[model samples]
Target chain A: MRDTYQEQLDELASSLAGMCDDVARAMRNATRSLLDADLQLAEQVISEDMKIDDVRASAEHQAFGLLALQAPVATDLRVVIAAIHGAGDIERMGDLALHVAQAARRRHPQSVVPDEIKPYFTEMGTVGVALAEKAGRVIRSRDLEAAVELEADDDAMDDLHKHMFTVLMDSNWTHGVSAAVDVALLARFYERYADHAVAVARRIVYVVTGQMPGPLAV
Target chain B: MRDTYQEQLDELASSLAGMCDDVARAMRNATRSLLDADLQLAEQVISEDMKIDDVRASAEHQAFGLLALQAPVATDLRVVIAAIHGAGDIERMGDLALHVAQAARRRHPQSVVPDEIKPYFTEMGTVGVALAEKAGRVIRSRDLEAAVELEADDDAMDDLHKHMFTVLMDSNWTHGVSAAVDVALLARFYERYADHAVAVARRIVYVVTGQMPGPLAV
Candidate 1:
């Protein structure tokens, strides 16, 4: 019985890590669709989001069952509860990617990102995917080191977001208000995607250490 | 022992409701600060956000204690679990308000919303506060009727959000790129604040009905 319980817990963690993988793919494809003006890729990201949501529901159900039947205590209890929260965060990351894809679709046939700003988004998207992948590994291994590194990675995403805003607000900006609004919102989506990844990593640190991770040095 | 356990569960619900109240006030003040360019109010909203975070941590601890000690099952278990999720949603609402407050502070002495766009923000702020207050009532009463109403209320927020985008994209827009970016993000903050409120209400419905709420009619 105890072995079964332990296996169930491990399965729950794997399910959440699977969610991170889905979000990573979604973020990458969403960014591609935006830069390439590929409606098909955008649509695919939007549709596949349901798969991520399904995983979230299943993970939550598993965690609920563990709490109800197995009555896991101590670190085991924290792990189950963290899974519940982590699932929600990862699901939200999927939603953020969906928003990015929808933005790409909205401006289809016309690339939403201009040439100069493309590099910023490319970097942001790269950072977003890396963070999501790291979050998945951290979830499976309970690696505090990797989790802490995710925080620094998130800072890089934030810097990219700020740079995007600076570009929008520059006196020489010629993209006009509509493009500015789109860029502002798109940058926000990628930044928020990174934030959720960090949130999932922090949850793992909490589960392992039984304490919230403290602030990282710069 | 059962009586004490029941009381703890009730206390958890109350704590969550109290979080709603804090968020409501924060949203209201944040909006006021933005519309009025009141730096002091904006600072207050920013500082008070910590109080809401404190409530979230305490509520989660309370739920965790109940899960570990009482080992609640079925409806009781759902309530405890829902408290964890609902607390997170409510805390996010508070954070959204904080974002609004920060925006107002960043542009202090210069009103972020121009004359023509003020009406949209005013209505969005009103809607945000109403949703937060209603979410509190739904948490305490578990009123499915009230919970459903929040969905509609959130629709109003979305409409306002869409309209703000339209206004920003309009050919007549003269606010320039910087102001457009501010309005875009501020409108998003209010819309998301309402979204979190709807999320909390849905959690209550799930606790009561043991199922997720269905999509609301347009």
Candidate 2:
């Protein structure tokens, strides 16, 4: 019985890692749709988001089952609890990706990134996906070192977000208000996506360190 | 022993309600600061946000402690777990309130919402605070009827959000890009604040009804 319970805990961790992988895939496709203005790809990313949601639901169900049946104690309990919340963070990351895809779909054929801000968003998309993949690795391994490093990885996205604002505020901002609004919202979606990734890493850190959740991510 | 555990559960619920009250106050003050350009009020709101964070911390700490001490099963376990996530949502709502105030402070003497959008934001602010207050009552009472009503209350904010966007997209939009950006972000802050309030209600319903969280709030 004890071995079975331990196996269930392992299963929960793998399930969470699987959810993170789905989010990473969504982020990649969202950035692709944005960069390429491919409405079809955008739709694919949007439709695939339900898969992530389903994974989250199952992961949570498993976590709750463990809590109820195994009545996990100490570190065991913390892992189950953290996985539940961490899966939630990853699921929301997918939703943010869907929002990014929807943005691409809304202005189909007209890329959300205008000529001037294209490179900035391209870099943000790249960084967002990379960070998400890193988050996935950290989720599965509970690599405390990499988990701690995730915050620094997020700094690139933060810098890009600020740079996007700088471009917006620049007097040379030739993009019309409409484009500016799109970029602003898009930058926020990516920035928030990165923040949630870091939040997931923080959750892992909490589980590993047996500490409370760190300061709320910005 | 059972009585002590029950009292501890009650304490957690009351603590969450306290955090909700604090968030509501922050939303009201944030709106006031934006409309009035009262730097002092904005500063006060910003500084007071930490208090909400502290409340969330203690609330989560209590939840974690209860989980470990009581080893609560089924409904008892769910309540403890939901409180952990619910406190997290409430804390983020406080952060959103701070962002609203920070927007006000960023402009200092100048209000974030321009004259044209003032009425819209005014309506949003009213709706935001009302929903938050309703969220508080729902948290404490777990009033299923009122909880269901909260969704309709959020619809008002959503309409206002869309109306604000229509104004932004109007061809005759005379507000320069800078002002338009400010108004766009401010509108979103209010809209998101309303969404979080409804999310909080959904969480309480989850606890009471044994339902998993409903469809994503946004």
Candidate 3:
């Protein structure tokens, strides 16, 4: 019975890890759509959001079912709880992508984003991908070290977000008020996306170390 | 042994409920400081933030220890997990209050908020207080129905937030780029505070019903 329960838990973990990968892909593609003003890709992200939502629902159901059936204790309970929280974070990540895509669609032809802001978006995308990958690694291997490192990567995204705001405030940009709002919203979305990813990493840490990491300490 | 475990779980729940009450009070006080432009009150919020953080940490630790030691299953496990997530949301609520307090300090003697916007600010404060209060009640009673109502209240906040943006963009408020940015940031903060409150309510729903409410379905 224990072996079967463990196998079921492992299967749930694999499914959740896959969902995280899809969410990360959607985020990256959404960012690309924004920078490139690709409406098709943006629409694709909007459509794919339902799939991410479904995956999140399934993962949540599985976690709860495992807890009920296995009556897991200690470490197993921690893993199940972490999976539930992580699934929520991943679902939100998909929602953020949808937000970006919607914004991209609104700014269609003239892309509110200027050439100079590309690097910030690029860095955000890279950090997002890294965070998602690290979350998957932690889920698979229960690697506390990898989870800690992912938290550190989130700091880099924060720095980049600050820099992006500075750029928005710079007098050089002549796109006017609407553009500024767009950039601010976009920056906020990316920063929040990174925040959720860090939260997932933190959950992983909690699962392995049995304690929540301090914000400043991380 | 089961009785001891149940008693420990009850203690943890009581502690968490107390922490939620403190957080709710902090949120109300912070919004009051913003609406009244009270620097002293704002400073009070800043100082109280530390206490909220400490309470949050202690509550989380207690919950973690309960799970680790008792190894609760089924509904008990769900309750502990919900408490941890609720504590996190409450901590963020305290943080949001700090954000409003900082903004109040930045405004100084001359309130950036014009008299015409007073009604909107009043409404926001009312909604914020209501939401915080509802969160506290949910924590105490585990009342899923009240939580659902709080989720509906968030839609009212969303409408107010949208209205504020519309007002800012209108030709009437000719307050240059800086004022526009300030209003935008302030609106974002209030919207986000409401969002977090809604999240707390949603967790309550999950704890009771074992399902997430559909987004915008409120």
**What DockQ does each listed candidate score?**
0.63, 0.66, 0.35
Clashing pairs in 2: none
Task: Please report, in order, the local distance difference test score of every candidate based on alpha carbons.
Answer: 0.91, 0.86, 0.78
Proportion of native contacts kept per candidate: 0.77, 0.48, 0.16
Which digits, one per residue and each the tens of the lDDT, describe model 3 over residues A1-218?
87889898898889878977898899889989999999999999999999988888788778767865666767787788788778878888888888988988987976858777777887888888778777877778877888888867888988988787777667775656656667777887888887887788888788788777886421
lDDT of 1 by residue, A1-218 (tens): 99999999999999999999999999999999999999999999999988888898889999999999998888999999999999999999999999999998998889998899999999999999999999999999998999989998899999999888878888999989889889999999998889899999999899989998763221
Alpha-carbon runs more than 4 Å astray in model 1: A215-218, B215-218
Q: Which portions of model 3 miss their true places by more than 4 Å?
A: A171-173, A216-218, B1-10, B68-74, B105-118, B216-218
lDDT per residue as tens, model 2, B94-170: 99889999999999887777786788877998898898888888878989889889899999999999888888888
Ranking by DockQ: 2, 1, 3
What shift in Å separates residue B201 of candidate 3 from its native position after superposition? 2.8
lDDT of 3 by residue, B1-218 (tens): 87878787777667766766676676677667777878898889888888878887787777757765666666787787777777777777778777777878878776656667768877886787778777777767888789889878988989999898788767676655555665677677777777877888787787778666786421
TM for every model, in the order presented, reads 0.98, 0.97, 0.88
Query: Per-residue lDDT of B49-162 in model 1, one digit per residue for the tens?
Result: 988888989999999899899899999999999999999989889889999999889988899889788888989999999999999999889999999898887888998988
Which candidate has the top score in DockQ? 2
In terms of TM-score, which candidate is stronger, 2 or 3? 2
